[model samples]
Target chain A: MQEKDIFNLLTDEGFCNYCLKTNADDVEYWENWLEEHPSERENIESQKNLIILLANETAAQVTQSEYQKLQRRIQLSKKNNRKIFPLIMRWAVAASLIISLSFGYYFYHKAQNNRQIATTISNKTAPGSTKAILILANGQKIELSAAANGTIATQSNTAIRKTNDGRIIYDGDSKSLLYNTTITPRGGKFDLTLADGTKVTLDAASSIKYPVSFTGKERKVEITGQVYFEVAHNAAKPFRVLTRGQTIEVLGTHFNINAYDDEPTIKTTLLEGKVSVNYLGINALLKPGEQASVKSGVSDIRVKAVDTELVIAWKNGLFRFSKTGLRSVMRQISRWYDMEIIYPETLKNTDLFEGSTPRSANVQSILRKLEVTGHVKFKVDGNKIIILNK
Target chain B: MKKGLDYINEWDAFVQAENEAAFHELYCHYFKYLSFIALKKGFPVNKVKDNINDLFLCLWEKKGQLNNVVNFHNYIVSSFLRKLYRKENLEIDESMFVETVPGLQTYPSVESQYIAQHTQDDLSRILKIFVEKLPDKQKQMIYQKFYLGLSYKEISETNSISINTVYNTIYKALEKLKIEIGKENLSAFSLALALLSLLCLIYFQKIS
Candidate 1:
C-alpha cells in the first residue's frame, strides 16, 4: 500500500473502528503492506508526527476580565448570602412588634385607659409612605393622589392615558409632538403609553419620560424605574429605551426594562423581536427569551436565557414571585398596597418565595395565601403588614 | 488567599491533593499554547478567557468528587471544547428567535438537540486547527474524515474524491503537524501524541 493509502486508511472511520476493535488480521495486513513500501516510510513518519502535534495542544487560558467578573460574582453571592440572615431576623422582630401592638390595643381599650390608648394607637399606626415628586417637562409638579385614576394629560397631540389597570398608554397620531413624565413613590405602581402607541407598565417606585408623539427617525424614551413595554410596530422607526447606564434599541418588539436607581445593574429582557443592548461599551444583540444585564461602569454585559413570562408577570396583573426574597416580596407589596415596610434586620435575609396573586386582591388576602405555604406569615392591621416567623 | 492560589489548588486537587500548585503552574506556563488552541477553534479572546476560567472553576467545584483524569491537558481541552459548544448552542438559540419571530413567522422551538455535552480532547483540537488551516478541498476532506468521523467510502461518496486522494491528504496533514512539534521534547511529545491518538480512537469509535 502507498503512504497516501495508509494515511487515508488511518483517517477512515471504518479502518479506525477496525483498529479500535483489535482486528489482528487487519493490523497484520497493514503492517506488512507498510513494510513493503520503503519509499513511503518518510511520509508515514511525518503522519505520525502530525498526529502527535495535534494531540499535544493545551486548553485555552482564561481572560483577566472573566476572572475578575467571576470573583465579583462570588463576592456578590457571598454578600447576598450574608444578607439573608439579617432579613430573617427582621421578620422575627416584625412578628414580635405585631404581637405586642395587638395585645397593647386590646388591653388599653378593655381597661378604658385613655393615655395608654393614645400611645398604643400611635405605635400601631402604619409606617410612612414613599414620597415621590413628578416633574413634568413643562416645569409643573403634579402631586399624584394615592387614589388617582384615569387620563392625566394630553401632550403632543397624544392622550397620556392612565388606566385603572395600573398601566399608562399614549394614544395619538404618530406625528404628534409632545412629551410628559410620570414618577411613582416607593409603594406605588403606575402605567403609561408612548407616543408611537407603546404601552408601558411601571413597577413600584419607578419613573419614565416619554414624548407624546414619535415624530423623529426613532422612538426614544428615558426610564428610571422598572417598565414593561409592548412596542407598536413601525419598522421604519426603531424604538429605543435609555435607562441608567444601558440602552436598548429595538425595531418593533416586546421587552422589559428594569433599571431601578438603587439596583447594581440594568437588566433588559427581550420578549419578542431583536434588540441591541448597549452597555459598558459593548453592544450585544439580543433575541427573544434572552436577557442582558449591565453593571455600572463595567464594560461587560452578562447575557442569560430566561423565561419571558416570569419577567413580565407584573404587567399581566399577577404577582408572580419566583425565587425572590422576603424583602423583594415586601417591596412589591408596599408599592401596590401603598404601605410602608418596617422590620427587624434579621427578617431581610430570608429569600425563597414562589407564589402568584391577583394585583387587585387586598393585601390581607395575599398574606393569608403566603401563610398557607408555610414560607411566610403576616399580621395585617389596616394597610400595614407585619412579617412574622413561619 | 492569593490571587492564583485557588486555581492552582483546584488544578492540583484534580491530579492529586497536594499537586494543585503544579496544575496552576502548568496552566500559567502553557497559557499561550492553550490560547492559541482556543483562537484556532474560533473562540473570541473574551470567550476563551471565560472558557478557561470555567474549566478551572469546574475543577475546583468538583475536586473532592473527581476520579482519576487520564492526561490532564487532554481533559482540560475536552472541557473547554464542551464549553465552546454550549456557548455556540446558546447563540444559535438566540439567533433562531431573531430569524423566525417577525418576518419568517415560524414558531420554531428555541431548544436544540445539540445541547448534549461533547468532549473533544486535545488531539481533536490540534487536528481541527491544522485541518482548518488547510486548502479548501483538503480541509473539507479532513473534516469529513476526522471531524465528521467519516469512512473512506463515505468520503468518496460525499465529495466524489478517490480513496487514494483521501489517504494522501490525511498523510500530508499528519506529516505537517509532526514536523511542526518535532522540535519539542521527543519522548514526552510521543507519549502525549500516542495517548491523544488512543483517546480520539476511543471517542470516535464510541460515536461511530
Candidate 2:
C-alpha cells in the first residue's frame, strides 16, 4: 500500500469512525478491507490506535422527568393514529356458524341408520362399587363400604376416618409407626388418604399397604394391581412406591402404576413432576405424559409418551380402549365385574376394541357394545364369560 | 449490551402493536447515548435534551418506513446525528473544549500497576502520556473520537470543519504517537498491533 493511500485512510472520516467503533457500517467495511489487504495490516492498524484511543466515554445521563415527558408524547401519538374495528370478527363468526348448521341438518338422517344398535340381556352384571377391606397391623378387619362415615379406629394417636363419599382418611400424627393394608376385591374400588396426606385411588382388585404414620427419612408404600396416586409433596422425605417388579421414587407427583400380577409388564405413568422408575437393574426417568414399562425378568425399561386420560379412565368411572386387544380388555372387565373370561383355543386374542363406555354400565351392555363389531360373541354362564370367535 | 433480538422485538411492538411500553423502552435505551453525542457536537445541554426529543418524535412519525431497518443501532445513531447537523451555520468555539475523559482519571496505584500489567489499561497508558502532549486541537479531536465516543463525521461537524480536515488532523496525531513510541524503544508495529487487538475488543462490545 502507498504512503499517500495510508495517509488518506488515516484521515478518512468513516475509517476514524470505524476505529472508534461508532458506525456499524464503517466498522464492517474496514474489517473486510483489512481482511483483503493483509500486507497493509500493520500500517492500517497504527492509524486505528490513534482513533481507538479517543473512544467510549461514559454516556451522559437522562433525568427521570425527561424520560417521562418523552414517554407521554409517544403514547399520545400512538393513540391518535390507531383506529380499532371489532365488528368484522363478530360478523365473520356468525356467518360461518350458519353455513355449518345448514350442512349438518342435511346429512343427519343418513348417518343415523348405520350408527345405532340396540341390545338387551336377561342377566346383568353390575359394575364395581366402592368397597374395600382394611386390615390393621394387629390382624383386625374393617369393611370400608359398610363402615359409617366417621373416625372408625385410632392407632397410635392417629384417627382412621371414612368420609361420606367413601374415602378413608388417616388424620393426625402417630407416635409409633404401624402398617395398615387396604385391599379392593374384585368388583370393588377404594380411595385412601395415608398419614402423610398422600391420596391413593385403588382400581378394582388392587391393594396398597402403607404405614399409619410415615417415619424415618422416607414414606414408603407397597402396591399390587392398578393404582393412581397424588403423592403429597415432601422434599426432605422422598415418597417411594414399591410394586412387584419396580420401585418408583417421587417428590410429590401424580402418577399411575399398573402392576397387576396377570399383566406381563409393569407400567408406571407420570402425570406431573418427575418420577424415577427402577426395575431390577434397569432405570427409567418419566416426565409428565410419559410412561415407563419394564417386562418381568427383563433388563430393558421402555419409555414412551402415552395419552394419560385413557390410562386413568378407570379412576374416572370409564372404560376407555383404543386398539386394545381382547385379552387386555377382558382382564380389566374381569376385575370390575368379578367375572372370569375364558378365551377358547379357536378365539383370536388379536381382536382389538377401540371405544369407551361408562364403567357404571352393566357387564352385558359393555359386552354387547364389543359384540356389535362382529368379531367375537360372549356366552355368559353365571360368573364365567366364554369368548367364542365369530 | 442488549441483544439484537430484544431491539427487534421492541421495534416490532412499537410499530405493529403500537405498544407505548415498547416505545418507552427504546426511548430510554438511546436517550443517554444520543444526548452525549449531541452535547459533544456543541449543542448546549439544555438544547441537547429538546433536540433529542425532536429527533425521536421525527422517528416515531416515520416508524412505518423504518420497519425494515436491518441495523437498528446504526440507523438510530445516524438519524440523530443527521438531525443535529441539518443546520450548517452553528457557531462552535474549538478552543473552549476541556480535556476530561470520564473514566480515565485513575491514579496509578501500586496494586493497579501490578494488576493492569499486559492489560488494556497498561497498553493504553503508554499512548495516554503521548496523547496528552499533543496540541490542544489535536488532543481534543482525539478525545472526542475515543473518550467521548464520537465518529469522525461527528467530530468534523462538531468543530465546523470538513470531514477531510478532521481525518488529516487525526492522521497527524497518530503519526506523532508512532514516532514518540518508537523513540521510547517500543516499536510502532508492536504497539499498534496491541492497540489493534484492544480496538477489536471495544468494537464487539459497542452498545450504541
Candidate 3:
C-alpha cells in the first residue's frame, strides 16, 4: 500500500474490521502486514490511533439520572432467588437452613407449615379451572366446561369443539362468518383456537369476541382482562387485538396482553416475532423478549427488555411476581379463587412481597406464604379474605 | 465502606451471592464512568439510563461466570456500554420507527485498559475541541463513521460518494486531527482506542 493510500486502506473494510476485532486471524494478519511494510507503518499507525479517538468521541456525556435507572434495572433482574419474606421470617428460614440445608428442605418446611394451617382447616378455594361460557352469534349461552368433550357447538359452518386437553378449537372453515364471544368467570380460565389457527388463552374474568371465520385483510379480536396469543401468520392478513385504551397489531407473533381493568397499565409482552402496540396516538413496536407497557391517562408508550418467562408465568400456571405489592398480589388471588378481599381500616403497612407460588395452590396455602413474610396475616372466611396487620 | 480497588475486588463475590448492599456500593462506584461511556456510544438519555440497569441485570445473570472473568472493571465498562447498544438493536420490536441495521458489525473485545485516567467530562471536553477544529465535511465523515458506527459501504451509499472517497474523507480528517493535536499529545489516540473497544466488546458479545 502507498503512503497516501494508507488512510484509505485504514478507513476501508479490512481496517475497520481490525479495529472492531473481528477475529484473531484478522489481528494476526494485520500485525504481520504492518511488520512487513514498515515504510508505511508511521502513517498507518497515526490513522489507526485517529479511528480509536473518533470511536471514543462517539459516546456522549453521562447523567445522574442514567445511573439511577441502571441501578433499578440491575435490582429488578437479580430477583430470581429473592424470597422476599420479611426480615424475621428470613432469619427463621436461614436458621432452618443451617440445621437442615437443601433447596428442597426449606421448601418442605414451608409446604408443611402452609398445609397444616391453610388447606386442611382454613376455608379453601382452589385456583381457576378450564371453564368458560361460549356465547353464540344467536345469543345462545353454552356452558363449555360443564359439557363433555367433542362437538360443543357449531357456529355458522365452523365446528366449535373442545380438544381432549379441554381447549376449544374451531376446526372447520365457516363460509358464513359470525362473531362468537367466549368468557371465563372469576374462577375459570380457557384456551381457544381461532378460525385462522391463532391460539388464545384467556385468563379468569376475561373475554374474547372474535369471528367464527376470519375474512378480509385483517383478523380482528376484542378482548378484556388478560389473554395470551400465539398468532398464526398470514403474510397477506394482519391480526389486530383491541382492548380498552390500546390496540396491538401483529403479522404473526407470540405475545401476552395483560389489560385487566384493575391494573393501571396494559402490558403487552412479546415472546416471538414482532408486535406494534398502539395507544392513544403513539405506536411502540416490540421484538421478542421486549414488553410494551401502555399506562392509563398517558399517551406515551414505554418499551423495555423483560424476562418473557416472568410475564407469561400465569399461562404456565405459576404466580410469578417480582417486588409485587401485597395489594396487587391479593388482587390476582381474588380473581383466581373467585373471592373478595377486605383489608383493615387502619392500614399502616408499606411492605411489598417479592415471591411467587403455584396458582393451583389452595387459597390458604397462598395466604400462608404471605403470612410467612411476617408483614400481613390473612383470615380466609368463606369466599372472603380479611387482611390485617401481623 | 470499601472504596475503589477494595470494592472492585469484592464485586464478583458480592454479585455471586446476590448481596444487594455490596452490589449497591459497587454500582455507585462505577455508575458515573459507565454512564459516560453509554452516552458516548450515541444512546439517547433515557436509554443511557436504562442500559445502566440492563448492564447490571446482564451481570447478575452471569454472576457465576464472574469467577472466571479477568480485568473486572474493563469488563464491566465495556459490557455496560455494549448492553445499551445491543438493547436498541435487539429490541427494535414491531415499532414502525426503527430501520434495522443491515449486518451491523460488533465492537472489539473489552480489554481492561479501555477506560483509563480521563473522566467522562474530560473526554467530552477534548473531543469537542477536536470536532470544532475540523471542517464541516470531515466532521460529518467522522460523525458518520465513529458515532453512527457505520461501515464504509453504508457511509459511502448514505453520502452518495464512492467507497474510496469515503476512506479519503476520513483519512484527511485524521491527518488534520494529528496536525491539530500534535505528535506530543499522540497518547490521546490510544486513550480513545481503549474507549472504542467498548463497542468492540459489545460486538463480540453479540456473536458469542
Residue-by-residue lDDT tens digits, candidate 2, B1-208: 4532347789888877777778777776567556554655466444666777877887778777777865565456545554555554432211111111122212222423343453365446665566546676776566565545566566777677877777677667666665666666654455655444334333322312
Per-residue lDDT of B79-100 in model 1, one digit per residue for the tens? 5555666766521111000000
Listed in order, each prediction's TM-score against the native is 0.40, 0.45, 0.48
Q: Using lDDT, give the best candidate's number.
A: 2
Docking level of model 3: incorrect
lDDT for A162 (candidate 1): 53
Alpha-carbon lDDT, every model: 0.57, 0.71, 0.68
Q: Tell me how each candidate scores on DockQ against the true complex.
A: 0.03, 0.07, 0.07
Report the CA-based lDDT of candidate 1 relative to the real structure.
0.57
Model 2 residue A347 distance off true place after TM-score fit, in angstroms: 1.6
